[model samples]
Target: MGTFASHRLKNIRTLSNQVSLNGYKEPSQSHPCEKDRISELPDDLIHHILTFLSTREAARTSAQSHWSVNKWTFLECIKLDIDWFHLDREKFCNFVDKLLLSRDNVNSPIDTFQLSSHAIDRASTWLDLAIKLNVKVLKFSEDRRWEPFYLDPNLVVFSSQYLKTLDLSNAVLDAIIFDQLNNACPALENLMLSDCLMEVQQISSSSMKNLNLIGCSFIKDLSICSPNLVSLRIKDQRMGNSSSKNSYLVFGTITLIDASNVEIMELSAIDSMFTFVEQDGSSPMFRNLRSFRLGPWCIDDNFLPLRRFLQHSPMLEMLFLKLSVTTSEPPSTDGETRQERSSTAIGWLRSEASRPLITLWPREKPLPPPPSEATIAAATA
Candidate 1:
């Protein structure tokens, strides 16, 4: 592997030299000092060149000759693509375990490591290695469904101290994952969790500035205390079987307490949760929120809270409601009260229909000219 990496690096250098020769605008003359100058470059400069290639490629270069051998060990970024090596699960696991144990003994500080694997055990080991290396950015993913029980969320937390960005998909996380994470990764700034099982619990953080939750199912109780969150996105898992409403289940209320500094919020669910309406005297959850998107088909009487919540966003610049409205089992209140409430809502929308729509184009664009008086009279005639 080391020899191959060295050869590839030398090839790259040759190609670069050829390009430089072709592109140089000045007349060149060979000087005896030129070779000495090239050889005088610090070892750090050669190691930087090796770091640009894959770990395998870099190692291959090390074996090209003695000069390249020690240079590969100074790599700042160790990126490994196991697929290119044609190794099975057992071989891959052993390879990573050896590399990590050997590298840690030398106290190597790996800035970045990307491992794509089908073996969960290998991934777990790599995670441990990353934590030991004090990796700055770690990306982990699997193409095969490895047993989930063998994976530990603690390892992820361990990586969080030095980790700045994390992208995890199609994995199972123990419920206590958040507890470990909150304690370990106080510096995490960007987070993406898609199709992962998270143990439902309180998720309080001031460090996360951007969050995306996509295609996740088991959200029992989600609470956010991050006041500095700038972008927030939550999307429901798509259903493919039936078009009917029988599959829908209204779960639990999702509360947001301290996320008032959000600027962009996109929320969509297959079921309705009482969306808190920010009122005149009420405390707003998202005070700086400018864009709000809600799945239209998910709204029902349960969504009245959300409508009421809208009044709180005085600075709201955009409102998108994709309603597939359905009727829910009404409360025990008399029909008269329900009718009155419905009427009031209709009247409010009617009155505000002519006003500048936050969801529409320009805030100053006049609403579609109200039905022409002549057209109304003609319909009556």
Candidate 2:
């Protein structure tokens, strides 16, 4: 009788504690942190949250719970990073095909679609979808190992009239491909191409306002005839050079015509020769250029080209130069320092500053300005 009573008492105490703990609510679990998490969010709120994540991560969220599982397919802006070429190609192709077909009922067009290509066949398929969806921003980054290869012709011809920004980096392309792209993309405004190889015979475009070509090689001559090119950046180690000695001897020229609206131009090239000559007998001018950055290899003698460019740019204001004393051609004296090279560059700028509407820096250091005077007056005089 005593043993039976002891067992009953222990069982009742255990049951009472289990009931009390289940009834009690923790402060954190009920409030904002866990409360605002995916399950608790409304459909619209969840859609906004998922937009920031890549398509892969957004798809994985479906495993979290029932609510998340049903909604992952509704993502509008999908960014597919197809870097793993080791995977079965057929599997990847089928997966992409299904994902695109699944979104046929979407209410809004895709805003951004970024892809990294290891397989051209897969990339072309994705690009076809972007055209169908009217994707606004399309970016393609090719794998580094695959080089001196051809691009899919469909990609060059595909047009997304609403495309506002285009970035093609680390790809081996040709001028013919670019010609097709420029013709297709009429509304494109911003373009960036870095570490790209193109035997670019000509660059023809319009409606492009900002252009950045970093670490890109040009073959014989580079021409920029776009009237709307407002800002241009050309920088990276040794741009537009061919390895062949005979090829190197052939002088390559860069032509900028009717670039009057450009406000900023940044250029950096090393172990390469360049000259910016305004087109002969042309009324074209740079009316709005305010800042200029030259290559580190630029010498005092290099300023000859800018004399005409400065005459056209009446509102020029700031200058940044990368000048070095050491060159393939040695300095006249051992005492020549980097500081002296900078001084030489500044002197050339000072000569250009004499223009009625431009400012130039003569000294090596930044100077304190009068507090009451306008910066334009200080910059000009």
TM-scores of the candidates are 0.67, 0.68
Q: State the weakest 10-residue window (summed lDDT) of model 1.
A: 360-369
Query: Which RMSD values do the candidates have, in order?
Result: 11.7, 12.6
For each candidate in the order shown, give its overall lDDT on alpha carbons. Answer: 0.56, 0.59
Candidate 2 per-residue lDDT, tens place, 1-381, comes to 346445533433332333221123223223354332445557765565555555665654543334533365566677665543244466456656666766655644677778766645557667667766777887887665555234566554557588888787666566766785577789888889866766666666788899988666666677776778878877653323423111222235666656777877765544345554466776547778777666544444444445555577676666556554344444535555545666665676666535443223322333223122265457556
TM-score of 1: 0.67
lDDT for residue 340 in candidate 1, whole number 0-100: 40
lDDT of 2 at 53: 51
Error of model 1, residue 113, in angstroms = 2.6
Which pairs of residues collide in model 2?
none
Q: Model 2, which residues run further than 4 Å from truth?
A: 1-49, 63-70, 83-94, 104-108, 237-251, 271-284, 296-302, 327-342, 351-381
Report the Cα lDDT for candidate 2. Answer: 0.59
**For each predicted model, how many residue pairs clash, with residues at least 3 apart or on different chains?**
18, 0
Pick the lDDT winner: 2
